[model samples]
Target: MAKYNDKELAETSKFLSFVLRHKPEAIGIVLDREGWADIDKLILCAQKAGKRLTRALLDIVVATSDKKRFSYSSDGTCIRAVQGHLTSQVAIGFIEKTPPQFLYHGTASRFLDEIKNKG
Candidate 1:
């Protein structure tokens, strides 16, 4: 396994966020319906996009993320974001639940009116 520094890890993590959460197509790869992508293919496609990615770095990133943003498949052959996916592409099986009667939201005062209106 290749050793990587904090900067390398952070940069790779951001790149992962871009491709995995937002635009897999940016690297000429497609995520599955559940948003999982083949880890090997992800590494290759990221290299083609001028980003350096390796299985080792990927492992570190997934292990170190403070927000628990990414997840590996049970078999460890695939990966996906835990949430924050574009619904058009990734149909993660989220459980449906009714909204609570009252909910507290945190936001800047400037956005309160909009939130009230939308809510």
Candidate 2:
């Protein structure tokens, strides 16, 4: 059976965190105002940046991340980190959100379809 181990999963998580949050430029991608980036574009950029990334792998990374950091757009075409994008050009919006360590913070309800809020 083919499956990703902890090291691979953690590595991918870090990579995703970097691209989805602080430096989309690392892979030559752009994030929207809400810190969401196109999943397809993210894959392509990661490839360009010398990372062997794929949609499947990305899904696994997002799923297995302990912090529940990343989320997919409603259409599943885009993704973003829950927080820690402070150094990013696009600041994630989190208005009228559930307080107390909003792990899924900035995920606007309107975009909930696009950017899901995972607990």
- Which candidate number would show the highest lDDT if scored against the true structure? 1
Alpha-carbon lDDT, every model: 0.88, 0.81
Q: How accurate is candidate 2 locally (lDDT)?
A: 0.81
Query: Among all windows of ten consecutive residues in candidate 2, which has the lowest summed lDDT?
Result: 97-106
**How much does candidate 1 score in TM-score?**
0.78
Give me the overall lDDT of model 1. Answer: 0.88
lDDT of 2 by residue, 36-73 (tens): 88888888878888888888888888877788999998
Clashing pairs in 2: 73-114, 74-113, 74-114
9-61 per-residue lDDT for model 1 (tens digits): 88988888888889888888898889999999999988887888889889999
lDDT of 2 at 100: 78
TM-score of each: 0.78, 0.75
